[model samples]
Target: MVMGGKSALQQSAERHLWMNFSQLGYYARGKKLPVMVRGEGCYVWDEHGKRYLDGLSSLFCVNIGHGRADVAQAGADQGKQLEYFPTWSAAHPPAIRLAERIASLAPGDLNRVFFTSGGSESVDSAIKLARQYHRVTGNALKTKIIARDIAYHGTTMGALALTGIDSIKEPFAPLLPGGIHVPNTSVYRLPPDRTADSLAEAVKRRIEIEGPDTVAAVILEPVQTAGGCYMPPPGYFARVREICDEHNVLMISDEVICAWGRLGEWFGCERFGYIPDIITTAKGLTSAYAPMGAVIARDAVAEPFLNGDTSFLHGFTFAGHPMSAAIALANIDVFEREDLLDHVRHNQDGFRAMLESLRDIPIVGDVRGTGYFHAVELVRDQDTKEPFSPEDQVSLLGYLSDELQERGLIFRADDRGGPVVQLAPPLIAGPAQFNEMEELLRPVLHKASELFPHAR
Candidate 1:
């Protein structure tokens, strides 16, 4: 069937496309959905031909920007050479080369790569690897995973168990067991009596409470993404690393969104000055040009599985597809060629300042995060840092979310931790794109402040 115009597209989408994490009822009720048709540089054009600045980098995955014909062509060329191949029992050239490349770039001794289809699978794979690593080393009871509160890991059963958000996990009761929650390093919301080190110490306390022998790994993002780009307090990771080492627990850096220049480094852990026993990454690995994810294990972590006839005992069919691997190689090439990491490092301060300028707004409570990733928290009382009621949060975020998009800006208007606007522009975005974001944000947010006056 030949696809028609926007109406037909919307109709088909409403009929067939069950979008992930979207309220299908809205589209079903005939609300006009923005159908993005094309993307280039730091912008994307909807089906109506209106262009919007991609402030969230297309869900924080499109790091090198979009519409790179060269990268797309690389996949096409590889498809022509070898359309598909599996990484189980046998290996292919693209997978082999990409693994070697990733191993070289990963920090410390994280040199072994196990490929998966996306972030959720990578996380699930890490969970399994951590458990198996303990079991093989004669400690079979170590199966629990300790993760931060309100952190979004992934949607798979194992990954969902690892996720800390309560609302999303409630519906899927009886999830994989042995998943424990710890406090995240959200310093903005830190109590007056508590220091940042206390957050790190919470991990130690949780480990002691749970018994070290029962905990297999402690997974964390360098900069927690879901709870409004929560940055790790100073010495947080260093302390966590020490705690994990002392307890013989594996440290897994879940860099699904933080890696590949999102935080001005090849890996987010590098930005925080720590190494992990395993690193589960995806999204920007191929700049989301193709579906791919990997669990990078430290040399020691891989040792138990390598001995004699022991194997990982787990695999995904399309984990290391040739074309996806080729696209990832090409994506890495784009990163190096454009010096995207250096680009983010050079301009991160400017980006932060732009967001910081909004703090004067009556509702703007705090501005936080690092590199291209940042967020502006909305509040009902600036002086008290009082958050909006659930009803008000829905109203405020809904208005701001719609207004921002209608005004040609694409970013995240979230209420995960609180009412916050998350911004993570493409690495290629500079002052010009920053100004575009500010231009779009200033008027809309100011209006929101006026319209949704703080209830005294």
Candidate 2:
């Protein structure tokens, strides 16, 4: 067996397969094709037999870690008992059970559970639901959605329109109409005089500018992800709620990345002490054991859509698949049994401290994250807080990421957060894993900074 040889399968994949959400030119050149063969616990083995820690949890999924036989068995058992069913007219037991459990865990009047295949589907579903809810309540003209800049809702046509990043939307021009943009609560990028009230005013101004009567809902992540793991400032949600109430616009807390122990809480909105009309989540719901996502609606968001001939008119074929539902139930069981939430609460300080220790490195400008999710923002200036230029970021940061990987750590070299190195280990990770992460990063980052010709 030649090392990483071009099997016909691999060769065909290179020539024919169109990969999702990637820079295809780079892929075609065969620079780095990391073929992850197997995973056990918090680590994975690549094709070359190199084992690296899955610090990013395989794109923030895989919450239960790899190789959970119980979850696999659940899927198999569901496949045998009921291979397929639709929730249109009839529902399966697993779906029903999981929905009730999720409803129980959710806060306030968010009692309805609408299932989808994944986060994007769930998000796409939520938008349609919001539109219908407004139409039913005699706010027929209120079909517009307001999402924050740099926020990512989903990639489906409906969901993509609500996504705030123009870069993603630019390629797919002339998407769904009435989707608007608002200023996000990324305090990291908050203006010099930006107050919570002022930011809220900025949001309110967008709604007003678009004519509040046309707006149906405002969607946001509890913590913005694509903008590079930005945390919400204190009083941000409170002010937003006030603005939403004033505008009669439904507020959506997109907990897709922040829910299920990622942020040391059940939901970020809960931690922030506010109630959103809808909460969308995925990624960790089943610990990524099975593909599953959910859109939860408050009583008000659901009640209107329930009566009459009007329906949300949206659902995925695999939505609430029995196998995924059962696996999710088991994943939740594991969370409770292991007391993972409490674990996150207790150990996050050590995580914070460990990451803050990296601030001494010249390239590390700011290290900000919450609970288990964190990122080290790399920069040029240690004092004035300047970022590396784009070209330097490409060469230096790119080189550093590979070096860190070679040293046996796996995290994100995130350009989404404006030249950051994202560190989001599993919730099960504790002081031991934290120490290992620091060990891998400290020297590698120092070396990377010195290697940069642009280094101050």
Candidate 3:
């Protein structure tokens, strides 16, 4: 019953589901967890009904796939009209019409939207609104925070001290301090004569050795998704927005998994033209059904809390939850009635030519990413690019994540920084879900390059 029939409330959710970031001692030893239940356009069906192919959208945040009955009837008519409220200091009407429709779909002059309850409280409320908008505009020694190397940017405690993945912040050791880190646009793992203007002058030499009025923000991620889908190079975020506008620093774009429409713009620094001063989104706004997130800023960083009493004193008790802002204004009305950011910018070049035709297999060394957020990268020496020897990256990412979820093709077989696989799918994923994800990723990456074999 638990496997296929899966009833009895799905076997009581493996005894009281504590699931975030899994491995709960393999579901407290019994090991069932694979539930899933249902979904539709773009598939999902587990609890043994099997099916799949939500690919990474379930994590990358559903963009507008999976049985979206008009975003669950606009969160069931805002839970029968205002199910909950609290943008604290009172505000409703679906969080003031979804914060005036995410400040008219965010971009330059971002127009202040706050809210949070996901993407690590919109990256710890845009690093406490960039250190209280530089201490109410007089730069009380800014307050440090750059990010890149293996960048993840979430988990809590000031976005886990701006998380750059030192083994997931080394067992959460004394975090939430200034938290700096760098070098990540990953010219396939840097080093060889580093470029991208020396990684944007290593963020202007780590904000001139953390002395540009004690640097208050830099946080990136136009792509760098969990540090593998990496991207950003060509004039890297226009040289980190000219090194945070010649060091007045406050870039902060985080876009929690590259904003809505996954990567075919609608943010992701407007497909790398660059315009930061804080963005921090959530997994495709309300595409994750309801839980929401935001931050947005830039009316010159909310003009020192728009004058008067000076209040940016952070918030969240389900920040802006009028049924997650009426399921984020009915998920931006299904992303403007299924334009889904121009259908992932007209099928992201056939999903980057079907992940660059898996670069002639042999451990698909580096396909990289752009839209529909790619990855691939596996190498053992695709002519000496040579990665994957952390015990063959946990036995070729646990055998291509259990043979591509037993051949139904759900993605993300990550290794945090190295071995890859990721994919984004579901912005109404096309070309027949990229030919059923390259026919379930080419024979499971051709049997994971023959059980992780490579070099001559």
Candidate 4:
């Protein structure tokens, strides 16, 4: 059965749909919802049949790209076999097999997998596991979590508490206690004397100030995704690992947007050369074809509970749905068959260079990030590194966001870390896609330069 026409879809959306993290009033203010109808490879077509490069990989989840009939069929076949089942006190073949596969791919002894519905749940589950792991191991006071400033973990109470973004957490004040924030690894913004070591040192200092005995774990994205794709400084994660180890605190790697082929590695921590005790993952797990997330814990973290009668005490009904597991299995197969990891590894340099070339744009302040994930920070003056004024931020981001989409490029124009444009194209995107991205971005960025003519 075909979906309704454009007007019906738009009306239905405006009348009923409540988009997450969206300004609904903006939609009411003379803007029709851009309804995407179909997707294939690195592009998605809007209701009007206008195709745009899937630059942000549909919120950085479509790792293998869209239109994978094989992946869909795998889930469909699983549905036919067993549509749904609760993981509580029960086991299913798809979940069992997928868990084994994920354990195989996960780094170190992170063998135990606790499935969740999505990234936020995975994070929340990890946070609970961290606290409970310490408590089970007799460090009940170790319930605090340390995260970097401006980092985005998730939106659930526990996860949101761990999130370091002030604006997001402001409205929902008095969150779960014990969530501490430290300086993120935005080396571009640091003083000339502050090296990457400073960022790591901040973590160590926070742990010390918080009293390491009271801190359960430190959760960080290998490359901070929501904080402008900020890649950690050299030796940052290694030192962070050392600090966590020294303090007897677990290190939780939140790879919601960094896992799979996004970082040219199975896990982002691997890309940075550290083994976190708990790894939270989602997004690319099933390439956004199905919703699934997992908290992969090291042996020590899971051992206490497994050895005793203590249960995790937290789970979702659809945590390890058979269909999601089956699709995830097929997703991994597609990754291996297509060599998505190697594809990203090989193409990232070109991808990065294409973005780096945009440094010529006057408004483009700093371009940072690794692998397929990247962001272009905007500023009024490149020399001074002066950020756009509050007025300019609103106007520039609005203009760029609208212009880029109008020009057939669909990515994120985020002000979460100043005015920035982030791109995380599908892993399958190559030179041709890179060219298209630059083709659309260059003119829009050029226009952005014209907006702040005084700076030019």
- The best candidate by lDDT is 1
What is the Cα-based lDDT of residue 381 in candidate 3?
78
Candidate order, lDDT descending: 1, 4, 2, 3
Q: Indicate whether candidate 2 or candidate 3 has the larger lDDT.
A: 2
Model 3's alpha-carbon lDDT is 0.82
lDDT value for model 4: 0.91
lDDT of 3 by residue, 1-456 (tens): 435544656467656867677776765565445678899988899866889888788888888888888778877887887688677778878888888788888887888788888888888888888888898888988989888777888888888887887887788789878989988887877787786668878889988987999999889888888757878778888878887898888888888778887888778888878788889888788878877888888888888787788998878788888887888788888888878888888888998898888788877878888778888888887877878779978888888887788778888877887788888887888898898899988888887788777875
lDDT of 4 by residue, 95-175 (tens): 999999999999899999999999999999988988888898899999999988888888999999988889899999899
Worst 10 residues of 4 by lDDT: 1-10
Q: Candidate 3 at residue 286, lDDT?
A: 83
**16-75 per-residue lDDT for model 2 (tens digits):** 878887676875676555667888888888767889888998878776678778877888
TM-score for all models, in order of appearance: 0.98, 0.95, 0.39, 0.97
- Candidate rank order under TM-score: 1, 4, 2, 3
Clashing pairs in 2: none
RMSD of 4: 2.0
